[model samples]
Target: MTAAEVDAYLAGLPQDQRDALEDLRKRLKSRLPDHIECLSYAMPGFRQPGPKGKMVVGYAAFARHLGLYPHSGSVIPLIDCAPFKTSKSGVLFTPAHPLPDALLDAILRLRQDEIAAGYGRRG
Candidate 1:
C-alpha cells in the first residue's frame, strides 16, 4: 500500500473522523519517524523496517468511533485505556475524545517492543 492510499482512506472519512484521524496520523508520524506507513486490513498503519516488515499499529474510522489497533491482542491488555472503549486488540475513541498522546506513545512503545522480541510478526 502507498501513502496516497492512506490519504484516500482519510479523505473518504466523515469530516470529524477525518480530522481526528488526521491528527492521529500526524502524531504517529512524529513518534515513529523511522517506521514506514502502509495500509493493512483496510486500515492505515505503520510497519517496521525490513524486507518483510511487521505491522506495528493501525487506525480506522468507524460509524460511532475511531480505533487504534496495535495489531497485537496482548498489547491492549498491557495498557491503561481508561475512559475509552477497548476490545481485545483495539482501543476505541471518538473525535470528541481522542486518544491522548501519552496513551498513543505507550501503545506504540509496547508494540515496538513486541516486534523486537520476535512476536506479532510473520515467520
Candidate 2:
C-alpha cells in the first residue's frame, strides 16, 4: 500500500492499537530505510525484495495482534527467540504488549540477508 493508505488504515484502528502499529512501522522504516517497502496485503505489510525477486517480508495487522511475516526460512530462529507469542508463520503481539526490539532487529537482519541474497519482490 501507499503511505497514505497505510495512514488511513491506521487511523481507523482503535487508538492504542493504532499507536502501537504506527510505532512499529516507524521503527521498521528508520531501521531498514530503502530495504523495506510498505504495501497492502490483506492488510498493511512491509516487504523485502527477495533474491529470486519475491516478497520476503510480509507484515500486517490482525484483530488482536500485529502479524510479522518473514518469508525467508531463516526467520524461524528469530521467531523462536521472539519474546511475544507467535503461531505458525508469524509473530503475534498485542497493543498492550511491549514491542520486542531484539526480535524486531533480528527480523530486520533476516530481511537484509534475504534482500542481499535476492529472495523476493515488492508487490
Candidate 3:
C-alpha cells in the first residue's frame, strides 16, 4: 500500500492502539529498510518480494495481536528458539504486549537469508 493508505488506516484506529501500531511500523521500517515492503493484506503486511511474488513475514495491528507470518521454512524454528508465545502458524502478541525484539530480529535475519538465497526478488 502507499504511504497515504497506511496513514489513513492507522488514523482509523483507536488512539492508543493507533500510536502503538504506528510505532511498530516505524520501527520495522527503520530496522529492515532493505528487506521491508509495506502493503495492505488482511492488514498492513511487511513482506519479502520473491520471483514468484511476495512472501509475508508479519503484520501488526490494534485490533487483536501482531501476527508473524514466517513464509520461509526456517522462521518458525527461529521463533521457537525464543521465549515468546506462538500458535500453529504465527506468533501472536497482543496490543498491550511488548514487541519481542529478539524474535523480530531473528525474523528479519531469516528474511535476509531468503533474499540472499534469491527466493526474494524486489517488489
Best by lDDT: 1
Candidate 3 lDDT by residue in tens digits, 22-122 = 77777777776654455645566565444344554656563565556655555565556444567555566666775667777777777667666776455
* Regions of model 1 farther than 4 Å from truth: 121-123
TM-score of each: 0.96, 0.75, 0.69
Question: 1-123 in candidate 1: lDDT tens per residue?
Answer: 889999999999999999999999999999988889999999999998777889999999988989999999999999999988899999999999999989998999999899889994457
Identify the leading candidate in terms of TM-score: 1
Overall lDDT per candidate, in order of appearance:
0.93, 0.68, 0.63
As a whole number from 0 to 100, the lDDT of residue 106 in candidate 3 is 74
Report the C-alpha lDDT of model 2 over 2-114, residue by residue, as the tens digit.
Answer: 67877888888888888888888788777766653656455665654443334555666677777777665566555565467766566777888845787888776776686
Score candidate 1 by lDDT: 0.93
- Better by lDDT, candidate 3 or 1: 1
The regions of model 3 sitting more than 4 angstroms off are 34-37, 47-56, 71-74, 81-83, 120-123
lDDT of 3 at 61: 60
Clashes by residue pair, model 3: 1-39
- Cα RMSD for candidate 2? 3.9
